[model samples]
Target: MPFAELDQPGDDRGELVGLLKRLGLRTLGDFAALAERDVAGRFPNDTIIAHRLVRGLSHRPPLRRALPPELAVTERFEYPLQRLDEAAFIAKALGERFFTGLALHSLACTRLAIHALTEAGEERVRVWRCAEPLTASATADRVRWQCEGWLARPDDRPTAGIVQLRLEPEEVIGGQSLQLQLDSIGHDVDAAQRAARACVRIQGLLGPDAVLMPVLDGGRGPGERVRLVPWGEPREATQEDQPWPGRLPTPSPALVPRQRQPVQVRDAVGDVVCCNDRGELSYPPAVVVVGDRPARRVIGWAGPWVYRDSAFAKQRHGRIQVSLEADEPNAGEVALLLNGAVGERPNWHVEGIYD
Candidate 1:
């Protein structure tokens, strides 16, 4: 809304009164009923004056004229400002004012507000929150950049141009004379602000969804266990209700899926031995050969294991046969001995490392 629009009697004043009523304050008498000092203490600045008007006091001295010794400054522009650059210039001037004021009072403003008087007379405001109060020039520069950014967007423009710019100190804290700590914090804050600004710029150039982060999900299978979400959104915590069947307490470092290999078996008499897919040696004197190297001897072996191939959708059949052994050339090593039809070479593959 424009500042000028605010001046028309029925427009702004009625709206403001309506807002006060929404806040449970109705009628001029309701505001007048409160003490002036109490009103100022509770609401501060123009808010108190606005309430006073509701109580029927039209003439009140501007609060700026009576402000205490603290770093604060305000500037009013005569001509309406249509461009962001012009507004930034005014902001810079206001910053200078604040610094000058602080210098006089021997204090600085840690937080400030850059307020705009829309051509329609309505106020549009932006705040500059700093980790600490800063020197006048630095404060002014920051305010200028902030105002420039706020006004840069076409949607931010008031129906009317902005006519006045003001910078006011909302809070103040003592600054160090040496400034070593202040400089460190300032660098960190400046870096963070710059990064935020860059992110905004990138989002503007690319659609918001163009940037994203990966989200981890709790599930037994690979495909069911991962997801993606917006970069800024918090990651979802692991679900407590769901149980993971056959999941290990400690996960394997390498989880890549590998192709299965087959192994050959022969009896002590060199007669070929055959086991059904269930991994049992058909004859008791069977010796395993891994890549043409005969086993030193047949030691204790675990099973002709059967695994369903249905878990891997891309494979033609879900049938898989495996064998486990405790004694082999690689003692204490877990070897995956596989089975295959004749004419197809048998294969042996190591699947894991156990300490």
Candidate 2:
């Protein structure tokens, strides 16, 4: 974050934050990148706190490594859950364990992803984004509510007994940071909860499908990574959790076209660049042409990452990130996400754009 946007209390008081900015340390990452000892040498007055912050470590008791913002607490049922009311009973015990685990690490959950599995191999996953850090009672309440809601929907209820339940913390904050929503200085603390309540009310007025939330699912192609689910329904994601080859990393394109536009990548010899079944690029991309427009020079590129479904599957899907020289007719930097499909030739398409 920017120097002015540091969440620390004294950071806004204009001494340390300003000093860091003057030294060209604009972001939190910039400070964290330097060695903790270097930061201590720079700020001798606040050596302890500054050094700790420089390492991106929290103020909690020291550990082998910094506590991660999120974690998962899983429970396997010896006696599978067959009845709907039984979930409430399970929730109490599970919530206690969940809270205790978070307490041990001095962390609190802001967003929670609940995963439930049934004896018949059915899996249901839902994520709840909360405005406040959830307590043990609140966690149990949410579990009971979610299970009750799913049971009320005949189509969504599990066919077999639930054998496993997992609570994955999606977003977390410091355990010591809990404060009153309406403080002396006016702030919109209830905004998130208000918005959630509004969605629930809308679902009541209309149908469950009235509102939808987008989830970043796992897939090789940019278009396949986004999965939209009904407002309160459990997100269904099979291609999300598993570690698969050719999956693109973070800094995904901000905008993705609904349909993949035909595009062509070529080498300096004007021959089409191809990705083989094993994902080896025939040649470095020199030019990229979207439709019949003027061919743009390839300045930067990455991948031709390939995804193989299984041993029996013959198809090989691949993707490449290509940065093209922008023309006067186009906007600033032109970066395109290209996808190659299975066939005799590399049929490229504009999967998305990093404008």
Candidate 3:
């Protein structure tokens, strides 16, 4: 609501309001009802200004005075915080106050950093990031989670009691853009903000690396095309958009092993299958042995797709994907990647399981 005093009677305006009153204009509403052109002509420049103020077009104390400083709310303990519960309560109260200040200014924090100082002068700091603006409840939950995790780790706990806590906004956006109308963000925006909050809490409980977000990059291989980064950390740049010759064709493999596991592919004649120098398989796969599992017959197989790495000689490799005749428990229509090069027997490993 607009300030009531802007339109109230007996405001400290001098002779202008006195003349308006003498002219039977008692309230600001009476002055506002006058035509702008008439008000501009009948009285001094202040009369036009008063009319605009009454109509809510101009602020009594203007909004253009100065932009507020960045949000940095701090709470200092007279007696240092000894218990985790005490720190958590302080954090909750701080979050409420901090976000409340932002709300008053029509602003919201997109990135926030938490700083904790111990009596011994040691400090622990971590920044939390979000795609959408965070709510105060989410901010408090994150703070509590972080405090709990720090207390739980005896090795990393504060040497002395914590004397000060600080919450600083690293980045902020206009809250009006996000809060002006419900349809501006839709329902998914709320869900996404909640999910981000949960992720922040989980990351606090575990280490930062525990929660990762996938980033797509330009690369020839399936594994190279995507990377996982820890939450709140900046993503490393890669040639993700670059076109490369001799890259594997899409649709790429759904599963790629983090650590390659070795197995054996055998022909019906009990000969180990091999990829020749010409990138051709010596024999069709019949039996597959994966990590001491009973040999399963091969149902179908794809290719000896060669991948050449000009930068590294040892990295040059070839791969063949095959379907197993017998499915492993919970792995329907199991597929295996047999990867190797010429003059060496190919090693079979589970690639992916079709649903």
Whole-model lDDT, model 3:
0.74
lDDT of 1 at 85: 77
Candidate numbers, best TM-score first, in rank order: 3, 2, 1
Q: What is the C-alpha RMSD of each candidate to the true structure, in Å?
A: 17.9, 19.3, 14.4
Displacement of residue 141 (Cα, Å) in model 1 is 3.5
- Model 1 agreement with the true structure over 1-355: per-residue lDDT tens digits: 2222223564345555555567675545665677888877866465665655555566575466664664445566678777767856776677777777766666666556667777787886655444445666667566656555545666654677776777778766654441555457646766865664454334333433545555667654333355665433446756524776423223331332354333455566876654444444555534665554546345544433333234553312111222335555566644332333322222333332223
- What lDDT would each prediction earn against the true structure? 0.53, 0.76, 0.74
Residue 18: error of model 1 in Å? 58
Clashing pairs in 2: none
List where candidate 1 sits over 4 angstroms from the true fold. Answer: 1-67, 182-355
After superposition, candidate 2 runs with Cα above 4 Å error: 1-187, 233-241, 309-312, 342-344
Clashes of 2: 0
lDDT of 1 at 343: 23
Could you estimate the TM-score for every candidate?
A: 0.35, 0.46, 0.66
Query: What tens-digit string does per-residue lDDT give for candidate 3 at 184-261?
Result: 555666675667777777888787889998887776566777888887666665775676655665566777778766
Q: Per-residue lDDT of 1-355 in model 2, one digit per residue for the tens?
A: 6656554674543677777778888777787787766665666645446546556677543567766544687889988887768988998889888988898888888788778888889998767766568888767767666666655667667888888989988777889855554453476646855676667545433445778888777876667788888775556676777776667766788789987688988999988888877668889999998998988999999987787656577777788999987677666768888888644478898878885
Task: State how far residue 153 of model 1 sits from its true place (Å).
Answer: 2.2
**Candidate closer to the true structure by lDDT (higher is better), 2 or 3:** 2
